[model samples]
Target: MTADARPWTAPVAAGPVTATVRLPGSKSMTARAVVLSALADSPAEILRPLRARDTTLMADGLRALGTRIDTSDPERWTIEPGALRGPATIDVGLAGTVMRFAPPVAALAAGTVTFDGDPHARNRPLRPIIDALRTLGADIDASPSGGLPLVVRGTGTLPGGPAVIDASASSQFVSGLLLSAPRFAKGLTLRHEGPPVPSAPHLRMTTHMLRAAGAVVDESEPDRWVVEPGPTQGRVWTIEPDLSGAAPFFAAALVTGGSVTLGGWPRDSWQPVDTLTGLLTALGAEVTQNDDGLTVRGTGVLHGIDADLSEVSELTPVLAALAALADSPSSLRGVAHIRGHETDRIAALARELNKVGAGIVEHPDGLDITPRPLHAASFETYADHRMAHAAAVLGLAVEGIRLTDVACTSKTLPEFPELWAGLVTGS
Candidate 1:
């Protein structure tokens, strides 16, 4: 069970699994809150922040920029915003949030902040954030090849006025800009022009958090946001359970002909996976939400669903796995941008599913899955957490399915294998 050392065989369910799975803090919300807290005018407290590889890197990056983060209790952090000064280096690993979000903050530091990551991390998009920062008057030096191994010359200030960026590659580009925009002299008015930003709900999450922290954000117009600059107020921020991380567990209900309950489901929230409840319902699962949380029960009959997961692209892998196990066909559309995620999700999903004897067609933008008798096979996780999640969900029904690099789930859900084992065994 060591990290990055072994390929684990996913366990198969016997009859029906009945368990309540508690997930860790939200990766999306944790990253955003940490970045915003670091940029706040005063120290702030974050309760239940995710202590995973990605979020830890973000905290380290902020600390490198002279933010005093007290992680004595890793879940509860009291972050004291200090004068931004960094003649330091940040290892972003493969976390897009750390790579994209930290740079803008680094742009406002007193000294240079050098950023790099794993070899694969260097291939993820950074030019959009780099170009946008340069447009907003921040001095940066980067390789001609596009990403990573770059230095931000932080003179401790940024002249952020108006800028336009093509955020179609990743919405993190837009959120990164706005997260650090309040520190700029003129605030910021940003316009995103492209073939629609993928994960639109993430942008809305950014807007909500910004507004909650006392930043004036106007997203009234299409593809444009206006933020009036002022000192960001620090407050007590509470992190939520990651709904995207809860996806595989909820899906376990369907694949095993069982029931799964997830605690702490937000009554009203902008997390993209809130839409998943309806998706589960359409796929022949009884979904219920109440004061306790959300519960999903499978009737042993799963139907395929045609879904537009562009706004909640992270859920695509788990959904695709379910589609492969359904009685009919499923079409998932509007997520071409996902090809640029942790891995080329479309290609990876198609290849891996087919290896296990399922029918999945990789489209330019999404996937078309037709149910087939899936056989046991080794599922390769391309170092993608969701990829591992998909395989784990499938393994619930199909035996002899070994998942390689299962430790990649540490990117968000650090205790994934252990938690999944507990759920499967109900011990």
Candidate 2:
């Protein structure tokens, strides 16, 4: 009973916008199919799975580590695997995928678990996955500012081999130790020394959903990753549609010149849909894809380019709100770790698109934007759901903007403001 900080005005479109938008599911493949179906061995079935709030706090932190899941079927949930015991406490609510994928499945739980969140999730970065889970043995206590209010102490297992980790500030610490490295005991190799793992397509969708839940994963040694422990064979796990939550309804068809679509979408997409269709076809947006999905029309001229969004960094706040309604300048470099996301999104998109008039500059990793003409202000959203989708694409075309919260778009499009006010009134 929380999310309603009020503010929220952002609606303004009323023009070209066509609209289709179905979106739901794939909050990064439902947090890696709820931590690979809670480290499956048999029972799985996750169908559509994306009931927001960061995949329902990663299935309630793997159901507080005992893992049963069920989720009463929004479309089918089911999980089941148990025996991952723990004195559990996990509430990773600000969810960087439940504080980096539920502390490596609570280090294969046995006793204590703990972990905390939402005070900006203790300045997010969890010391390179708590120093690679203490070099793969896992007894963790972290928080000498390493991040979060940690404590693992589990002793049922976890002695996964070779560690290393410097996931360049979060590739979810090499996908939270390769999604419980096949229930560890000597099943992980992992490498990545430093500086260069910025969402390489979410680590190739975490080694393609850990080789589709059967887990063998070799990755043929580039930044290294071996896996190989054994069991993990769950079964069904559909979830596709969220091409980065269809970037603000395809930036409402490129800021209202109009089309949208995004219905079934998935002509192959583990997210980062061809780098978001080549950054929305280099900001002019025509983006296609058939069988009733991915559309995004708006050629009402918007250009301004330079890109480099480090493997589509969560579509950098709706491509920095379509580069502040582009016409000319935009830079958006390789995302300096989105300044540890959920907040410093390039200094909150250069202080909320230069408080509406947009001229934005603040760069260390990105954002230059320069097309100024916009009016109306307010936009703050530091609670960041992509800064309330860059203040709802700068309120469609800047009217009154507003939006200090928009309930942080319920973490992952909890129906982002009634699907963006029914895509600007085409309701």
Candidate 3:
């Protein structure tokens, strides 16, 4: 199912919400894992892979390029590597992973592949990755705006070598190139020559996953990564639960002075759990991890915080919502790159929060939210999943909060509405 045009009335928490949420697999990890599995030396199995729209699109795109992926089993999807050839058209929806990660993989195909997406997707930043691909010897024709609605003319192989990119706009640009580097003829030595790249942890996740798949990678130096040409080994890849998608549930706990536990988290997480813990702890949430899972308990006292969320920018929307309900003021910085996400998050947050009477000052990189008396209002999601999560968190305390389209959450979490209702009702 796609996004529903009907507006959704967000549920308000009658009391402190207490529940354990079992979220799906991480979209980022699943996307990268699927790509690697398709390019592996042998057939591979991705255990508990995310079946969300974004990941499904990635799988479909790979299938168009002749990779055999059997996703009939929801729990375990199998992949068989084949000759990457394409004379296909790919619809990326609003997924950054599909827009960025799939292009490099498509470059390895034998025919031309036309790429497009939702209307807003054409506005996302794609030039950096497109230019980087060209630097490494791939034929691409981007739109006049240097964004999406482009075509990749593949010649069966890529002459990958040293390349430079300005990835300050999005970390996916770097990860995209690195994910497909091992398949290139000469491998890749990528260097970043711009402002500090956002989402450092995501880049680490990319490198870690690559190395785990038997690719030789060197990240000894800052802003530089060297990937030696080799075959990625097919193995059983168990995807971690999406910590980012769980942010709204955790925020619900914090907002209602309740508790929430997320199950199936790995002992050592590839996601930015440390950063999330620190941010939530700073806002008066007690976080603990053990055999059961990761639990966050609210003390009924929400404190304001000043944080730079560059590395974990994906958490900005929900964190910003928490800031709106804090006792004092909060300032979030170092996420200017989010302007190119599904929407201009900073502006959208400021506009919507302020519409409900929250005092917010929009900055180039982030927002400063001051606690105010919030009331009922219609929150616009702008077709962004994270924005819907933020609205849900705010609705827990502020009654009558409605979302323009809760179905937008289907982009990452299709079960958001049911799960959120259960959390509020303690089902």
Candidate 4:
């Protein structure tokens, strides 16, 4: 079941699924922490980091650039700073973190570091980060196509200064710049232009991590960030549980009229996906926080909702799946940028949902999902983890649903199939 190469039948819950799920650490935080550790002056320890495809890819990418990272313990990473020497090749594996975050670090290498990823990753947004790095004095050749199969020729160091970029497509562009800004000789002052950036919480997460690493960052101005040039100080980092990865389990409760509790749910968090707590409540689930964690109990009544998921577009697939089974229509908007994700989420959702007999419309930036009786079908994952999660949630209510590439969930939650199987069946 861990292998995604073959199709896996999505298990149907016989009744309400009641279980306490313990999620892995945040992939977003793990990737960032790895980057920060590599940039630091001394060795640092990252505890409870997610050990999954995406995060492992990031660790491998950093090692390619001459950073010494120890992965002996899957739960902890020991990073030792080293002189960066490249002529290295990084396989991004459709991980947005590896594709977007590594390039900035590559700019500090002495030689050329080439970046490529899965076929689907070639189509995702890479231009903004490449263009922004070029603007800030990094020698990068992306063939002007600005997608992938790119190279960064590091001059040992960069003279970073004021630069302007459009990050409407992916906030990773802005975060990539900020994360590496401190290594620049002159630091950086980046201003964002064009449409408003999606996933503001992620951007904030970057800033918070940077500050925690002893880097000076200023975000007093809208769409502007200022980072002071300096060496990053090493420190121990503890990654929190991934709220985004918990989406499917929560949706399982609502779908099967069950109850589930998530351990290690942060009392205060910048994770945009934490908004799911409210969304679940609005969907006729009772939510309460206890010493154990966050518990959600479904009353067997699911209600459709109108929600703008622009800031937390990662939740779109599962939410869309839930909406398809709701009592009324639901409109999910402000996530056009997701079109450039691992796959075109909006189109994929509509196409796959309709294949199973749901009335879902793809919009310029969102979806309009109308409640319809859903039947089992072979749900295609498109190699995107969230898409796999959607199929799993829908499968709880609709039997005989075979998820093509359930292995894709390993991108974030490596034990997804095992964890999911346990949650529904109490195995």
Candidate 5:
């Protein structure tokens, strides 16, 4: 569902975003919720599940594999798990949600199931978890480089074995193991044996969701988690709004001199949006809360902040947008995991922001962006949805910004352009 195909765009100084926007459900939560609900025996109801392309793909893929899913409502879904029949072929189509989460979820199916996806999905490294699942008696195989186009023959030949899995690169691997623990012949115990793993909060999110769906999770040690295998008892689950997706607007409220309200955002969310409220406040923004939402108003020239976003790395683009208007340099750390995204985000930011006349430096772990005068230009999103969404937010701070492949945001936000239109009160 791509929108607005104009020849090109010159970035315009964005009007203060004062609209009361209701952000979408967490794609992360939505995808995992679908898998958990599908793995159970009873009917499952998920409220406010993300309905964007990635999550919808998860639902469709699971349904194609013989599970019953009803997603007639944009905000919710009903998942019914039952008998698995036939050798199923499923396509996830660049949806990391379907690719990473579905494989383990598919292990629960009784017949042979083959998983294939688009080029980007095929490129992501899945060897660590694949190796771990193989250790636990899963019959799965990947290409020579552990790329996708994976083939998983079903549970009939399921093995019961144990091995340590390295989760240093991405948390999805760990979450996959945790989500499908019950299906494994013998429940899996993972050993984290590298630099502290990335996206720890997302890992926590998955574990918390699994427990909510009725799984036993053990994290008795600092770097280890042991999951006991059992069926997820179907129940009610609610997906929280994505704090990552709301970061750009929150930054807009801090620098654009107006209040922006976001509804359905919780006072207590694992998401990083509210945590940055202090950072926004420190940057000269006034924040207030109401019954249904939180609002922000900017007072003056924004100031830079020092922060760490290891678990909240999705906020990088928004932080970069604010740094462009701040008085000093902004430094953020714990972002090495971004390389696993559609594009190497650090490199993409350094390259693309430079096109807009910003002085930015890329680090192996994070980025250093210093505020500078802005220039108008078209930027490449490199087919990365986050990169595309980030470019649009940066457009708010300055003028003359065009993002190519803007449709990429469909991975999580298909109507971002429309949402922005509403936020800016533009047609």
Candidate 6:
């Protein structure tokens, strides 16, 4: 999915740079919505399913399982619930959600289901899920590395017992477990026994999706939870705009002293959008929200401060980009979970930022970025979506930025560059 990137150099727009850009639906929430809707026994309405590659792949996977979903409109989905009475084979097309979330959803089927994903997704690790399912009486056959190209043969008689899965790797591991908990005969009890669950709010979103579809969830602690069995009731569901997806724009507002209004944002969201707002405000951004999306305006000068982001690792790259312009040194803490994302985000950010002008310190978990006037430079985006995006935005504060083969954003936002063009020179 690498495309020859058109070389772009960021110029300080002497003229006030201003524009209202349209953002995409949240990939995280959209993927969760698809899964929950598939579990519904009746046709469920999913408003504003993201049209990006990830959600499209998920919708396709569900369709292969005989879940009829109407994808005619980009803004809504009508999901017809059904089952995959395999021998069935489906492809996830490079989406982490499908690779991480599909195993257990398939476990509810009465036959063998072969699941595969995109080339990059094929590299994502799945040992935790495989181990957890094995503990829950699921028979899964996959490569020894515990990667993709998975084969799951459901017993259709799983007596769900105690499951203590280590989620130090990915929160999706815990979410996959929670999504499938309702299908088990004996219900579910889970323990997140490794590093604290990274992206913990995603778990909240997962359980929220499950409960909305009809199930009982009891979250006893940050590390443990119990679920009462229930099949999805398949009600009409609505999808809120992605707050995580909105982080970059919010940070953009903070970086250039520019202002942007975000619409379609959710007031009650597990996404760390609100948290990012506090960080921006701390650094001198004026933020406000109403029925529209959050509106953020940046001040000319920003001061560095201490903050932890282990819970919202996906937003780290954009934060790192913003930190480079802060007056003092800024450190992003609690990011060890970044090691397991689409790429080693901590290392990717540190390496790429250093390529231009910023002084960066890389930790196993997080990074520290210092203020610098960015000069024109070429960069490799590491085929990571966030890396491509955060780097481009960083370039906006510089003389210019030239990104090479930077088309990986298609994994989430297919039209990212087109949107960026409007922001740069106001095309």
- Which candidate has the highest TM-score of all? 3
Model 2: how far is 381 from its true place, Å? 18
Model 1 ranges with Cα > 4 A deviation:
1-3
TM, every model: 0.98, 0.35, 0.99, 0.97, 0.93, 0.94
Q: Cα miss at 280, model 1 (Å)?
A: 1.2
Query: What pairs collide in candidate 4?
Result: 4-407
Q: Model 1: how far is 259 from its true place, Å?
A: 1.5
| Per-residue lDDT over 1-427 for candidate 4, one digit per residue giving the tens place of the 0 to 100 score | 3343768888889999998998999999999999999999999999999999999999999999888999999778899989887889999999988899999889988999998888778888888888888888899988557978988999889999999999999999999889989999999999999999999989999999999999999999999999999999889998888988988998888888888998987777657645777888888888888778888888899999999888889999999999988999999999999999989999999999999988988899999999888897988898888999999888888888898888788899989999999888888
lDDT of 2 at 10: 84
**Candidate 1 RMSD computed on C-alpha atoms after optimal superposition onto the true structure:** 1.5
- Write the number of the candidate with greater lDDT, choosing between 1 and 6: 1
lDDT of 6 by residue, 18-86 (tens): 556557777887888788777766778877767887788788877766788899988778888776566
Q: Name every residue pair that clashes in candidate 6.
A: 9-400, 9-401, 10-400, 10-401, 94-118, 262-293, 263-293, 336-365
Number of backbone clashes in candidate 4: 1
Model 2 misplaced regions, further than 4 Å: 1-25, 39-95, 107-122, 125-140, 146-151, 157-235, 243-245, 255-260, 263-291, 294-316, 319-323, 326-343, 346-348, 351-427
- Cα lDDT, all candidates: 0.90, 0.84, 0.94, 0.90, 0.75, 0.76
Per-residue lDDT of 109-134 in model 2, one digit per residue for the tens? 89998989788879877898888888
lDDT score, candidate 2: 0.84
**Backbone clashes, candidate 3:** 0
Output the number of the lDDT-best candidate: 3
* Residue pairs with backbone overlap in model 3: none
As a whole number from 0 to 100, the lDDT of residue 303 in candidate 2 is: 89
- Please report the TM-score between candidate 1 and the true structure: 0.98
